[model samples]
Target: MNKNFTLFNVLPLVIGWIGIKYGINWLTIIATTVIVSRSIMSLILSAKLHSSLSHLSETVRSRYRAVLRNPQLTFSVAIINMISLALWGQEESLIILAIATGAYFSVRHQLLRKT
Candidate 1:
């Protein structure tokens, strides 16, 4: 229905896919569920935004593209996820919170700029 909703749906699916590749135990399952749910939401929420993929800086674009093209980013995100998960059981919560914060900032800066 909206871009943010779309992003919310897509972000988790992408994140979950990464988690599945690099995740361990129950986390992998959680990631898979998130992936499926996000994918559905993303598809339902499609809008008129540019390809999220097209906005990357040249260097980042190349690197991330390479990572996405391969399974490396999944491993990397997995590692980070593992570490975050290890951090006193607060990892997932914090990461989600951080993601939400980032999303808020992005929406403000890009879609809702104050002039």
Candidate 2:
């Protein structure tokens, strides 16, 4: 994984961990709020993009389809990893969480840049 992406994924977790240690609910709440907001924004943007596809020329449509491929595939992996985290032991869950967060950041960053 790229260092910057990894850093982006890990930094929030680290802050949340500290909050947990200190019994600070606001930090955890803030993190959850950010994640939820980002997810909502992504959903809106994706819906708009898909709706606009019909308006593009055939060549552009083909190029866009090639570039976009299937974003749902990425979301599927993230969902599976999350489910695994719930089923895993503490150490294993942490690893799964890290991987999932990395994937989330990577996809979110890539899509943001494209838009």
Model 1 per-residue lDDT tens digits across residues 8-52? 444554555466566554654565455344434433332222245
Q: Whole-model lDDT, candidate 1?
A: 0.44
Clash counts for all predictions: 1, 0
Compared to the true structure, candidate 2 yields what TM-score? Answer: 0.45
- Estimate the Cα RMSD of every predicted model relative to the unseen true structure: 14.2, 9.0
Tens digits of per-residue lDDT, candidate 2, 1-115, equal 4674344334445555566678786775554444444445545655565556446676766565565565675455446434433432223344434544455455444444553
TM-score of each: 0.24, 0.45
Number of the top-ranking candidate, with lDDT as the measure: 2
In angstroms, give how far residue 39 of model 2 lies from its true place. Answer: 0.7
Error of 1 at 54 (Å): 24
Which segments of model 2 are wrong by more than 4 Å?
1-10, 57-77, 80-115
